[model samples]
Target: MDLRFDHLIHAVSDPERARHAFADRFGWHTVAGGEHPGFATYNALAYFGLPYIEWVGVRKPEVAAERPFGRDVLRVLRAGEGPMQFAVRTNDIVGMADRWSRAGLVHEGPIEASRVRPDGVTLRWRMLFPAQEPGKLLLPFVIEWPAPDEVRLADLRQSGLSPDPAAAPRLRAVHAVVGDLARLRRSMDAYFPGVLEPCESSEQGRGVRWTCGEVTVFVWEPAEGALRRVLDTVGERPFLAEFERTAGVRTRTAADAARRLEAAGAPVHGLWVVTSE
Candidate 1:
């Protein structure tokens, strides 16, 4: 039941504008995504590898108001376009659900869902949403695709959807600015058991870093600083997505990072964060 960071969901007012924004911001190849059959939402996508960016917008307000996930998207968009959610890829979703039950964590389905691709092909999968807990950052939903993870990666390459890992700046981490970083770290241990590790305090603030093979999730709570202001403003949410820079990327101050994060609200393309390391 090993899980890896899968993709970031960015909520937007318009999916097409988001696609163009990603193209302009990172020079990433974007696709014109299609509608989800039941959710009343549509998407625009940009793939760096397995962990891609999904820009989702409400297509039918009445229908969207009926679905919980759709309502979540609408709530995020009301605050303006920004990173909305994250999900992990898993192979054994049933086992994961059992584990969650044993751990005393509440969860909703291994629900079956599908989106009809613009090319008229249907892509199906199952998702399990872990309820968000107090004092913890938002819990990432778990996704189990129809094929094995490697098979999906290969298919993405063959379909010309994902760029080669070495050539593209694949998503490296999702950084959350939240209150009580220590409590969030403890909560993650309950959900993920021992994968999260200690991270040093720096321009990124102080928190724990969780790695699930390919991508990392960082939770930070700074003392009266830019990151703290973010928590005060947005409450607990993922504020920045780090991507591997091809060259000349160095760390910046929290103020600079916060400024870049503000820039992310427009058009909903993820903000670029890279470390010299």
Candidate 2:
């Protein structure tokens, strides 16, 4: 599978605010706006290291395209909240998609040159959705960038991005909570094969301890309860607070972060962050 951190998603109401917040507070640099066709979004890029952070905002109806993942993005936009989605970069889009298809996983076709980053870098890949059932968090979507180095992080450094290694955001880690845990692990095993060797976790939660250069993903077991508890824990002081301030967006604290987040009026389904290097 050769999976690694591709990017983390942050949902915002105002793209401009999110951009400035990242640059001024966290020292992350953002490229200009680019179109996300199906998702109807105007997105920008910020880097932790190689894999950049994708800050996406729903575009106005006038210039926007179809809403890809149904209307989940629009919901997040209403809330003006934290991490929305995460992606894994595969070495081969076609081969991986073929394998997934053989395994009976349902996904979208490999759109030739589907999405382009704001830096003028074009990404070529296909996306796969979980088959039959949906919302099982083990594997959200699989993406493979075309080989021969179409878009390297180094190429975008000239766009007001810093070369200093220390400028990267201090990402502690990334965490996800899902209704199913064991099934999620099994699904990953079937798809990615031997790629789970370095992961570590427990019953209370499922976590993959990242190597020195990789980002960790903590997938917790979800229970039937008010979404507030889940949101609260993720937004608890140190992480969400610092994120809002450092990222320069709203929702910097527990007291009102939830309220501000929900202000977008989107159903708070799930949230996660891709920590910086």
Candidate 3:
């Protein structure tokens, strides 16, 4: 069972605004991502190599309010803008869902989902969402892309999105805020065995880190109001902060990114600066 980090979902009030803000701060342009039709949501995508950033928001409140997942995303937007959830990709989605079911973990679907690009090419995939729980937000939803691994990047480029492989910041790690470290570790072990390792945080707390291909995921105790919202709704969600490692030695610091975000008027809570070697 090999699970790879797919993309990070950042819920914002305006996908276009979020896209421009990201461009201003990171120097990477986001291409137009089409609407979710029946779900009443749409997105703009900032593509990296494999993992990317998806800035999603509601286009129609009434229709989106009808669905549980749609409503969940909308709630995050209502609270403010920042990361709401992340996803993991697998080649065998059905097998993965079976494993979760056998473990007594409740989940929904291998649901068929698709989006039509502006060029009229439709990209389709299947997804599985875990049953909502205290730490459910910390757990990634499973996704299976139909295309072969090698052509995934090319497919995105063909869909009329500009993915600057050279300028796009590589995702270094995803920081998840959880209540109980031991319990989350147990769940992760069952889903993807032998991936996590105990680690120390620079912020004076303990955390567990795991690598899925090129990206690292860190789960630690909630540190801010935004993180606490992962368990509630008033603040934000499980994604406390995201760190990016740039391609150059003089990449922008967190403070620089914060200033850029502030100037752009985007929510700066869950986003950190880009670090470089």
Best by lDDT: 1
**lDDT of each residue in 83-157, candidate 2, tens digit only:** 666667766777877887888766665654356655565655566544424322335456665553334545545
lDDT-best of 1 and 2:
1
Q: Which of the two, 1 or 3, has more TM-score?
A: 1
The sequence of per-residue lDDT tens digits that candidate 3 reaches over residues 44-141 is 88777778888888988999999645786787766677787888899999997888889888888888877887678787888898775552466678
TM-score of each predicted structure versus truth:
0.85, 0.67, 0.81
Of candidates 3 and 2, the better by TM-score: 3
Tell me how many clashing residue pairs each candidate has. 0, 4, 0
Q: Against the unseen true structure, what C-alpha lDDT does each candidate score?
A: 0.73, 0.50, 0.67
Candidate 3 lDDT score relative to the true structure: 0.67
Off by over 4 Å in 2: 60-67, 78-80, 113-126, 132-138, 147-151, 161-163, 170-172, 197-213, 222-228, 231-277
Ranked candidates (lDDT, high to low): 1, 3, 2
- Please give, for residues 1-277, the per-residue lDDT of candidate 1 as tens digits: 4888888888888999978877876678788888886778999888877888888999998889888578788777777677777888888998989998998988888888898776776899999888777333277888989988788889888887887667678677677777676776666777778877666556546676667667777666766666777677666778787666453322234444555555455323434444322
Best by TM-score: 1
